[model samples]
Structure formats: C-alpha cells, structure tokens
Target: MARNLDIALLRTFATVADQGSMTRASDILHLTQGAISQQIARLEALVGTALLLRHPRGLRLTPAGERFLGRIRPLIITNDEIWSEIERGDVSGPVRLGLPFDLVDSCFAASLKSYCEAFPKVELTLVCAASPDLLDMVGRGHLDLAVIERAVDSEGGEVLAIDRLVWVGARAGQAHKRSPLPISLVGETCVFRPAVSEALAEEKLASRMVFETGGLDATRIIVKMDLAISAWLASTVPADFDIISEDAGLPPLPSFAITLHRANGARGAIFDELARQLRNAMARPRLAA
Candidate 1:
C-alpha cells in the first residue's frame, strides 16, 4: 500500500508556509489551530519527513518543504483558479476597481494580479487615487469596488483591518530631529495629511512642507534620500525607511480602518468573491525583502 497526499493537507501546508505561522494560517483558512497542526502532521507523515521546523520566532520550511512548495505552489494555484471559475459558472463582466495610490506597492498589488489571473475574462479597470476620491467614486457608482483607508472611527463600509499609521524617515536620517520638521506629503486631498498635520500641531512641533507629490515612488525617493519625513501605514512603509516613534519627538498618529466599499448595483457573487480574495491576500503577512 502507498500513502497518498491529501489536497486539503497540501492547502494547509502551503498556507502555513506562506503565512509563516500556524495561527495566521488558521485565521486565513478558517480552521482551528489544532486542526492546522493536525493537517501539517498528517502531511509530514505522508512524506515521511519533517516539513516545517518550529522556531522561537516562527515557522520555517525545511529543505524538503521548500522544494515541495516550489513544485506544488503552481499546481495549487491552478487548481484553485479552476475551482473558482467552475463555482462562478459563467460569471463574466467588467469590475471597475479603485485603489489608493499608496496601496499600489502593497499586498493589494499581488492580490489584484492574482484576481486577474484567476478571472481573465473579467475586465478589471483600475484607477489609482487618494482614498477620499476613491471613496467618492465608489459611492457614486463610478467604481464597482474601492479599498480605502479611513479614520479608525469612521462609519460605513466593510472594515477589513485596523492599520496603525506611523511617521517614517530615511534610514539613519537626522531630518526628523531638525527644528521645524521637514515633511513630505501627498496632497491636500490625502486622508492622512490633515490628521498628521493636526497631530504635529497638538504636539507644538513646527514643521515645513519640503515636498508634495501624489506619486508614491517619488515620495519614497524623497524620504529615502533623507529629504523629509512622512506618514504611512506601519505595514505599508518601505523597508528602507525607519519608523519614527514618540521617543523621536513625533506625535502618535491614529489607526486607520482599512475598508472595502461596493456599489449597491454591484452586489453579486462575483463581487463577493473578489472581496473575499482581497481580504485573504491582505491578511497574509507582508513579504520579506
């Protein structure tokens, strides 16, 4: 008799590998922690070797596990795509998507790509703008779905994650310590601009707007060059910069409500599935550089 690999177990294993923690995998898969452990144990038993190593920090893939992942990841993705297409059953239409400019380099980029690959027939028109503008577009039915970062206590829309906003500056930069802090901002329409300004004012910290741009890449370059400090969601901050703290004399910024809004006319299975995929992708841990 020969042991057979289980698709369910493989799915759980891949999720754990992607998430780097059983707890996070459980959350993403909607399974109990014990259940995820059991699935991994069963998978290891099938292969007759350890697939994952438990460490103080988190889970790490064994050499065998890494090779196995490389082989099976494409298969799993293809299988899921097929299953999704079959489940949707002839659902095809255009989905107008609105993304904030800041999110283009975040997890949403990968998610959007995955969604497009899975449903190639669904015409996805994406527009990048500030959160306020995106929200307005979605509310007016200009976009089928919009992902926006709103103030933590703001109402309306399906909240996905509560993300912390932080002050960030170039690595080893002394710009943050300068009197009348030099700052870079998106624009007046940016949701973070007013909050960040108000926080600075409340702390009686004088600041100078040294740069302003709506492009995240340009802003990143300016920050990386130690030109000025700017505010960003902690998770979305580029790896090159250092997050400033109160000890650095920067006032604390409020958390943001990562919300998803759908137009009333766009309520359907396709919309729900897109939202589900987005949430799953966002829930995954940020990719390590």
Candidate 2:
C-alpha cells in the first residue's frame, strides 16, 4: 500500500500546530471548523496515530506528532515557498549542512543567521557531529555540504580556516598543576587527539584522562568545575576558561585546518549560496596564540 501524504492535510495540521487551536487554524486556512476537524481526522487515520490532543488548553502535539513535525516542517516550508513565495525571488528547498561540534560557537553561527534572513524560504537543516562522521555524510550524499577538520595539507576538503589548538582550563584552576593532571579529551577519531596526546607525551607529562566526549557543553562544564583541563580551538574556548600559557607547563598544541566539503551529487543555487556564506565567514585570519 504505497501512498503519499496529502500536502493539504499536512498544511492544515501544521497550521493548527503553529496556532495551537482548531479555530485559529480554520481562520487562517479559510475553512469551516467542521472541515478543519474532518481534515485532521483524515490525516490521523492515514498515519494511524493520534497526532494531537485537543483539550481545553487547545491542541498539544503528541510525542509522535513532535517527531513528525520536525520532519515535515521542512517540507511545509518548501511547499509554501513554491506556491506562495517563489515569485518573491527567494530560492526554496531543503539543504542538509553538516559541521563539527566546536564550530557552532565560532563566527559560523552569525553567518548562518544572515543566510536565513536573506533566504527565508530555504529549508536549512544543520547536522553536527565529529569531523569523520560529517565527512562520511558528505561522501554518501546525505549532506549537501560539510565543514570538517584535517591536518594542514591532508585532504578533508578545501581548507577554509586554520585554527590553533590550545590547552584550556578553569580560571586559576589547579587541575593543570595537579599530579597526574586531570584532562578531558575528545574521541580517538578526532584529528586533534593524536597531536594533543603526543604533545603531552613528548613533554613527559603524567596526565589522566578524566572524561571523553564530543560535546562542547559537557567538556566546558567539566573544565569549568576545575575537574580537568581540556583542549579546544582557541576560537571555541568559552570566555571564562583561560588558555593555559606556555609558562603553565603544558606543551604547545598543533593547528588544524578547517575545510569545506560538498556532496558529490549536490548541486543548485541554494546550496551554492550557503556554501559561499560559510566560506566567507570562516576563511579569515582567526588564529589565536
């Protein structure tokens, strides 16, 4: 039984979701209240699940509805642009963008905001993961483009930025001076791991791996509590954390080249627009000592 979801029904459901009331959705869609209710019922029957709960407080999305909405909201955005916004001179379609976890805090976020404002009709999806994972997605055509990390001249993609790695710690923290210095490290697959660990080894520093994660927030929290010292791109280090000076006895870290990768199969004006934005934002002099 192959069937396509009715865009009309989806638009009705999404309208109600955004408005939070059947009456409000009916007003926007210019349909009678009974017609609105009937459309919602038809959609739920087709999906074989109750997508919403109608109560005195109005419509609240069920768990399934929440999941469905995240997937379909992009569809709705594209659809609305084709029907109503295309003539406005804005391109419309879904673009899957991937990047490493640390780059989110850099100037990339500001460029993303500007891109969205310039092309509101584009359905932009952001996927954050490790550099290797992001590169894999780009290779398999699961992402339109990705920003990844690699050695200075190694092939990850086209180099967009060069970021210096630095030892980070809580302000005035004792973790750096403690015997068997506590340190939080990223996953083994990370490009920085080998360089960071080897740097410490060459210095004969006795350190303990206190935690391992690919997440920025968790690493920041662990380091902020003075539980461990961690390494990060100088640009990604939080304001409160101090980059341990060389006099602090930590070995210097190597620099990583940030690069842009495009899906082999991806092509279109919208994709190019975003790629240009990221390149402009990142391909600048941002190295920190």
Candidate 3:
C-alpha cells in the first residue's frame, strides 16, 4: 500500500524531535503552532498511533515515536545531507589548513584561488609552519588538513604531493665563498634539517650549523646578510640566493613527500576532498618546480 503521509510533515516531525518542541519546530519551519499540531496529527493518523506525547515541559516522543525516531533518524539525516549537497554542491565554510611557508609560493595561492572561485562561500585560514609542526597540528585537530613533508613517523600522515629537495644559498653566501662556511639551517622538527644533514653526511663534509630558526623569513634574513648558507626548495630561494652548484661538492638533495591527514570520518572526507584538489592543482605544469 502507498504511504499517505506528507514528506513535509515527516520533515517537520524530525525537526521537532530534534529541537524538542512544536513551538521551536514551528519557528524553524516558519509555521504556526496549530499547523504544526495538525501536521503531527495527520502523521499519527497515518501511522495509526501517537508519535508524540504532549507534556507539560515539552513535546516528548512516545514509545512508538522513540522507536521510529531511532529507525529513521539516520535516513532523514542522510536525505538532508544529500539534499544539502545538491543545494550547495559548492563547498563552503572555514577550511582551516596548515602548510609549510615554502609551498605557498607554488600551488597554495593559485590552487586556493580556484577552490574559492569554485566555491565562493569557502573561507580559508592558512597556518604556516615547519613540516613537523604542521603535521603535529593536523594530527591534534588543531588544523583540518595540512600540506606537510614526509610523515614524521608511522602515525605521521598521508602523502599528497611529492617533490625533490633542492639546495639553495645566498648568491654570494658562504656556500659560494672560498673560506670556511657558515651553514644556515632551519630549527629542529623541520624537514630541511634532516635533508641538509644527510646531504652533508653523504659528502663527508662535516658542516657546522651556525644558524637555526623557523620560517623562511628567518632563513632568508640570515642568508641575505651573506653570513650563512641554507638549503631549501630551488624555487623558494630568495632573489638574492642561488643554488649551490654540484661542483661545490654539495651532495644531491633528496626528494620529499607532501602529505595530508585528517581525523577518521566525515571530517576526514572533507579533508580528503581538499587534499585531492590540492594534489590536482599541484599536478599542473605551472606549479611544478
């Protein structure tokens, strides 16, 4: 037999159940109390039983209503989600993300632009930090997603983009100088530190870390002074910096992975979608460095 209940009534019932009162549901649905009562009455008649108990405090679900609520809550919710997805198929809201300062110059700007253009309601708040710190923040729920270098460990992250590491230095910095070198390095927990260290170890050149700090600005500052040399993305090299040529005996830099991670569920799906867009954007030839 065909069901005769109104979908609108079921929607109102679900909203009333969720909001806990007919008056509240009326306000939500912009209906009068009498109309709300009539809708509930119609639903009760169709189902051949009472769905709600009129209570002094508020409307409460009857035993039948309780069972019905449990059974249809997820279905209604899923329907709502699907309808919402159809209505605003475009993405929206505060997309809190973390990323290393270096990658911003590459895809972060243009890719995010495309994301925003495609979904104007999206508002992004970007947190810049070292790879390790970014990963930690993403893992802790402090950030929704992150573009991080390799996972710090097994529990680290998911690889989203990968690129080869490259060495850079001040155009006339120590790496380009003849005398003993002043090596500028990033602080601990940064991906560059290990990359630089391993490169030095392979060359059997025991270089000293004369400067250590976070953020590209700090590295660029010391390098601009020509007081020390640092390694970073070839593209991230400041205008005053140059790549340390292989003839200088610096070992070839290693490749690093850009990864993304999220908490395990709906939030994860959201982040995964963002990560996928980032990966696609980075894949564009223009962003490749």
Candidate 4:
C-alpha cells in the first residue's frame, strides 16, 4: 500500500546527477543507456515527480532532484562505509596514494588526515608529483590510486570534478600588464604550461618565462611576490592571489579534468572506501566551482 524507494534506482539517479549525463552514468554503472533511462523513469514514478530535466547540452537536476540528492548522498555514503568495514575484516594493508604537487595544501590535506584517522591500521604512503608522472605510477602498479589533472575533454579515468584553469597573479600585481608578460611555471612537464603558452601566443602576447621550478612552492613564492603571472586552477589558487580574466587582456584558459586513476586488479571494500573518500575530497564545493 506504500511505495518504497529502491537503492538501485537511487544509485542510478545519483550517478546521473553527479555525472551530469545519463550516458556517463550508464558507463559508470555498466548499464545500457536504455536501462539507465528506464531506471530514472521508474524512480520518478515512485516519487511521483520528474527528477531530471533535459537540456540541449546535457541533463540538469530538477528542484526535486536536488533536494533528493542532498538527503540521500550521505545515507549512501554511510551505507557503503558500513559494508566496507564489515567486509574488510580489520582493514589492515598498504595503500600507496599519488597526488599532484599542487593539491598538497588543498582540501585533500584534510581528507587524507581524516582517512588516516579512519583506517589507522592501514599503511598509507603518499607520493606527490606532476600529473603525468602520477598517472604513470598508478598505471605501473606503483600506486594504488592517484588524482591527476588533464585537459577537460581528455578521457581515461573517473572524473571527480571539472576545474577552470585561470591566469593568476599576486593581488595588485602589474606583472601581467607588461608587454612581454612575465610568467612563472612549475615544470617542463606541467600540463598547464603548454596551454598557457598557446593561449598567450594566440593572443599575440609576447611572454618571458622569468621563473620555472619543479615545485609548486617555488612557483607560489614567485607569483605571490608579484614577480610573474602564472596559470592555475581557479579552485587551487591561494586566497592571496588574484585571478586574471579576459578583462586583463589574457586569453581564456581551458577547463581541466580532475580525475581518479586506480590500478588494475585493485578491488576490495578497502579500495572502494578509499576511492569514495578521494571523490569526496576532490568534489569540494570550492574546487568544483
């Protein structure tokens, strides 16, 4: 006599909302597109309201969908955690984590601390490096999981968030206004370097690399001192810096793909829990904005 919510349908709906497309959700869930649609429809019928709105570009969550997701996401996460703990049976093992150098001080710092506290018996090894290097480590089985940034449209891993790359400079810095814009960069292999260079070249703006380092801290110091302008994700930029825009005569930088790369054959409730926490870490509201 009373309708009951289905976990399967709720999962499908949540995946669609998180991914912004039923197609992507289907891929993640290993379900056919038609099946995904049917699940959504069934869920809607159970709730007696439409949960998704179709748009020309993709899908958007309706008002009801937003409310439903906010309430259910935590429940789903807690449920998963409970299962993981039960299946893990003491959950003691080594987990090698690879992260990009830029994210060390970001929200992930807190996430990592929380994870360590949650699984004190598990040995966690962290290696911070450039994205490409991190990806290689994960692929080679040297790391259990990694968070890397790639071109927005580039495909490969599970995307946690889409980040906007923007030109950054010190507050009140005129370094960007110079005829030959002074720039500082992280490393030769840094993903943002090529994009920044290409964008400047397209705008016919001459630029000089005044400083280059293999570390983010060095780059931060240079940019913070108003020595040079640099490009970084809007989310990762320090609060002390200012984001330069088109108004500053800089070409728009491309969006970046923030993704989770996991080693093959790495399955288990522990690994699943780690991935879930990593997703939560990277999906911070400020980062995704």
TM-score of each: 0.70, 0.66, 0.60, 0.87
- Once superposed on the true structure, which residue ranges of model 4 sit more than 4 Å away at CA? 1-4, 21-23, 30-35, 53-71, 81-89, 287-289
Ranking by TM-score: 4, 1, 2, 3
Q: Across residues 1-289, which tens digit of lDDT does each residue of candidate 1 receive?
A: 9855577888899878865678867865779999999999988987889989988867999999999877776666556556777776555688888888777667688888877777777788999889999999988999998889899766656655667899899998988988889999776678899898899889999999887864777888888999899998888887778888679868899998787788889876677668767666665667522
Per-residue C-alpha lDDT of model 2 across residues 132-235, encoded as one tens digit per residue: 88888888889999998876646445555667888999998889999898988665566678888799899998888888764767777889999999888888
Task: Choose 1 or 3, whichever is better by lDDT.
Answer: 1
lDDT of 4 by residue, 87-113 (tens): 555666888889888876775887788
Question: lDDT per prediction?
Answer: 0.80, 0.78, 0.66, 0.82
In model 3, which range of ten residues has the least summed lDDT? 151-160
Model 3, 1-289: lDDT tens digits are: 8744456877778767755677767754679989998998888888889988878767788899988766665554445446445644545677788878778866567777755665567677789888778877766878887777762233345444446666666665565453455676667667777767776777677666667765567777777777777777654555656777878766787766566655443253344446646655553454232
Off by over 4 Å in 1: 1-85
Root-mean-square deviation of Cα positions for candidate 1 versus the true structure, in angstroms: 7.5
Return the TM-score for candidate 3, rounded to 2 decimals.
0.60
- The per-residue C-alpha lDDT of model 3 at residue 240 equals 58
Identify the superior model by lDDT, candidate 1 or candidate 4.
Answer: 4
Q: TM-score: which candidate is best?
A: 4
Error of 2 at 181 (Å): 2.0
The number of the candidate with the highest lDDT is: 4
